[model samples]
Target: MKTAIVILNWNGQKLLEQFLPSVVNFSQNEADVYVADNASTDSSITYIKEHFPTVKIVENTINGGYAKGYNDALQSIEADIYCLLNSDVEVTKNWLQPVLYVFKNDKKTAIIQPKLLDFKDKTKFEYAGAAGGFVDLYGYPYCRGRVFNNLEIDNNQFNDISEIFWASGACLFIRSKVYHQLGGFDEDYFAHQEEIDLCWRTQNIGYKVKYIGTSTVYHVGGATLQETNPHKTYLNFRNSLLNVVKNVPTRWFLFVVFSRLILDGIAGIKFLFELRPIHTWAIIKAHFSFYKNFFKFLGKRRKLHKKQNYNLHTSIVWQYFALGRNRFEELR
Candidate 1:
C-alpha cells in the first residue's frame, strides 16, 4: 500500500531542523512526505526547500489552523495510508515497519498511534499523547501515560496491544480510504481534540483503533504551544464539549453533562476561594457558552448519528464512562 506522511507546520523552523533529517533518512520505501505550512512567518519554508528538496511542501496564504491546513494538503494527495505526524516528533528507525505491519494485519483497524517518548527526556512519555487516548464519561480525554498537564514516566512496563477510543494525531497512521470517508479532521475543532472526533466516527463505522507499542517516536511535548498556551486550552475545552454533543447518545449525554457540571462547580468554587478567580471564571464562561450554543451543537450531533453504528445505550458508552474520571472524565 502507498503511504503519504503529512505534517502541518506553523512557525516551527527550529523543530523542523531537528525532525526533518530523521524523517528523510528513515522513511525510505513506499512512503512519501508532505509538509503543509500554515503561513509560518519564520524561515520554515526557506529551510525546507534548501535542506529537503525532495519533500513536498504546500504553503498556505494564512494560518488556517491545523485541521484546515491538513484538509487543504490532503485534497491533492492519494495514498492507501496517510500518516499524520507532528513537526516536533523524531521517528525512530523501522518505526513505519511495525505500523505497516499492524495496518496490513488488521483490515478492520482504521487508525494506529505510535508509542511516543519525550524528546527532551527520553525516559518519560510525552504530555499530549503518550500511549493511546480515551475519553471519560464527562467528555475529557486522557491517555494511559499522560493526564491533563501530567505526563508519566516510561518504565518499559506497558506491552499490551489493544483497542483505544482515540489515536493521537501527534503521529497517527490511518487508512486513506477510512480517513476520506470520515471526512478527515473536523474543521470546527480547529486544533485540539480533532483526532478524538475523527476516531469516534471511525469506531462508529465498525472499525478498531489500535495503539501499537512496537513502533516508537520521540515528541517534544507542547513544542508548538506550551502549558500556558491559551490556544490549546480554548480549543481543548471547546472541542471536547463539541465531541460529547456530536457523538454521545442523548441519555448518556445528560449523565455526562450533569456529572461534569458538579465537578466543575466544586473546582470553580475552590479556585474562587483561593483567589484564582480568573481561571474559575474562565471555566464558567466556557461551559456557559457551550450550553448557549446547545441547539446548534445538537444539530451537528444529530447529523453525526445518522451514520452512527451504535446508539447511546451501547457498550461503547458504557466502557467510556465506567472508568474513573480522566482528562475527558472528571473524578470527584
Candidate 2:
C-alpha cells in the first residue's frame, strides 16, 4: 500500500535538522514525506525547501496548533496509509516497515505506534510513549517503559506486540480509512490528549490499537511544549479529564474524577510543602477551573455514554498506583 507520512512543525528548525535525515533515510522508498509547517517564524520552511526539495511542504498561513495543522495538511491527500509523525523524532531504518506490516496483515488493527526511545539519552525510553500506551483508573497515561517523568532505559525489555488504550500522537501510524472515519484528530483538542480520545473511539468500534515493538524511534520529549509550560499543563489536565468525561461509564467516570481530585490535592500540598508555591497555585487553579466546566463536561459525558458499549470497572490508569507490579500483569 502507498503511504503518506505527515510531520507537523512549529518553530522547530533545529529539530528538523536531526529528524529530516532520519526520516528520509528510513521512509525513502516506502512513504511519501510531507511537512506541515505551522507558519514557523524561523527559517524552517526555507531549510526544508533547500535540503529536501522532493519532500512535500504545506505551509500554513497561520500557526494553527498541532491537530489543525495536520488536519489541514491531510485534507486532500489520498493514500492507503497516513502516518502522523512528530518533528522531534529520529526514526530508525526499519521503523516504518513493521507498522506497515501490521496494517497490511492485521485487518482488526486500526492504529499502531512505534517503540519510542529518548533522543537526548538514546538508551532510555521516552516518557510520552515508550512501547504503546495504557491508562490507569484515573485516566493517567503510562507506557511499558515510562511513567509520568520517570523513564526506563531500553534493555530489550519489551519484545512483544500489545494492545494499547491509545497510540502516541508523536508517531501514530493508522489506516487512511479509519483515520478519515474518526474525523482525524479532534481539532478541538488543539494539542494534548487528542490521540487518546481517538484511540478510545477506535476501540469502541471493535478495532485494536497495537504497539509494534519492532518499529523504533527516538523522541525528543517536550520539544513543542515544555513540561512546565502552564498552557501545556492546563491542556493536559483539562483534556485528560475531558476524555474520561466523554468516554467512560457514568459511575466509573465519577469515581475517576473524585480520585483525580484527591490526587491533585495531594500534589498541590506536596508542592507547597516543598516551597514551590507557583506550582502549588497552578494546580489549585486548574482544579477549580476544571470543576467550573463540570456541567458542560458532564453534558458531553452523557452523549458519549449513550454510544459506549464497553464498561470500565477499574481503568488501566489507576493500576499504576497499585501496591504491586502484579497489578499490571493483566495489562501485558
Candidate 3:
C-alpha cells in the first residue's frame, strides 16, 4: 500500500525543527512525508522548503484547526493509507512496518494508533494517546495506560495488538478511502475529540479501529494548548458533549446526556476548588455552546444510518473517582 505520513502544523516552527528529523530519517523510506501547513504566519513553510527540499508541503489557505486542516490538505494527496501524525511526535525506527502490516492483512481495520509514550519522561505513557483510546458510558475518553491524571509506567503490559474503540489522533493511521467516505471529520468540531467522533462514525459504518502496540512513538503532550488552558478546557468539554449528541445510541442517549450534565457540573466544582476558576467558567461556556448546538447536533445524529454501542466501560468517572480504580487493568 502507498502510505503517506502527513504532519499537520500551525506556527510550530520550533516543534517541526526539533521533531521532524526523526520522522524523516525513520519514515522516509517506508512512507511519503508531507507537512500540511495550516496557513502558518511564521517561517515554517519557508524552512521546510529550504531545508527539507524533498519533503512535500501542502499549504492550506487558512488556519482550519485539525479537522479542516487535514481535510483541505488531503484532497490533493493520493495514498492508500494516511498517517495523520502530529508535528510534536517523535517516531521510532520500524514504526510504520507494524501498522502497515495490519492494514495490508486486515481489510476490516480502518483506523490504528501506535503506543504513545511521554516525550519528557519516556518511561510513562503520554496523556494524549497512551495505548489506544476508549470511551466510558458517559462519553469520556481514556486510554489503556492512562486514566484521568494517573499515567502508568511503560511495563509493556499493552504490547499486544488489540481492537480499540477509537484511535488517537496524535499518531493515527487510517485508510484513506474510509476517511473520505465518512464525510471526513465534522468540521464544526474545529479541534478536540474530533478523532473520537470520526472513529465512532467509522465503527458505525462497519469498520474496525485497532491499536498496533508494537510501534511506539513519543509525544510532547499539550504542544498547542496546555492542559490547564481555559480554551483547551472549553474545547474538550464542548466537543465531548457534541460527540455524545452525534454518535451515542438512541437507547442510552437521554440517560447519558442527563448524567453527563450532572457530572460536568461536579467537574466544574472541582476545578473551582482547585482555584482554576477559568476552567470552571470554561465548562460553563461549553455547556451553553452545547445547548445552542443541541438541535443542530441532533439533526446530525438523525442523518446517520447507524449508531453502535460505542462505550467500552460502564463509567470511567465512577471507577476512577468514586471507586478509586486508577489503572486500566483495575477497572473491571
Q: What clash count goes with each model?
A: 3, 7, 0
lDDT score, candidate 2: 0.79
Off by over 4 Å in 1: 270-276, 306-332
Model 3: per-residue Cα lDDT over 1-332, one tens digit each:
99999999999999999999999999877899999999999999899988888799999999999999999999999999999999999999999999999999999999999999999999999999899989989999999999998999999999999999988899999899999998888899999999999999999989999998899999998999989789999999999999999998999999999999999999999999999999999999999999999999999999997898876789999999999999999996
Off by over 4 Å in 2: 292-296, 302-332
Per-residue lDDT tens digits of candidate 2, residues 1-332? 99999899888889888789889888888999989888899999999999999789888877779788887888877898888999999999888878888888999998999899999999988878887887766777667787656577787777678887788999998888888887777775688888988888788777889998888898898988888776676777777777767777655766877888888777678778988777777776766666777787677555542434333325443444463332233443
- Write down the TM-score of every candidate: 0.88, 0.90, 0.99
lDDT of 1 by residue, 1-332 (tens): 88998889999999899898998889987589989899999999899999999899888777878788888888888899999999999998988988888888899998999898899999888777788887666677777777665566777655557777888879988898988887888887778888988998888878889988888899886876776554555566667777877887666778866766776677568668988776676677767767887788788777663433333222222343465333322332
The TM-score, computed over Cα atoms with residue i paired to residue i, of candidate 1 is: 0.88
**Total residue pair clashes for candidate 3:** 0
Which has the better TM-score: candidate 1, or candidate 3? 3
Best candidate per lDDT, number? 3
Question: Between which residue pairs do clashes occur in model 3?
Answer: none
Q: Per lDDT, what order, best first?
A: 3, 2, 1
Q: For candidate 1, what is the lDDT?
A: 0.78
**In model 3, which regions exceed 4 Å deviation?**
none
lDDT of 3 at 50: 88
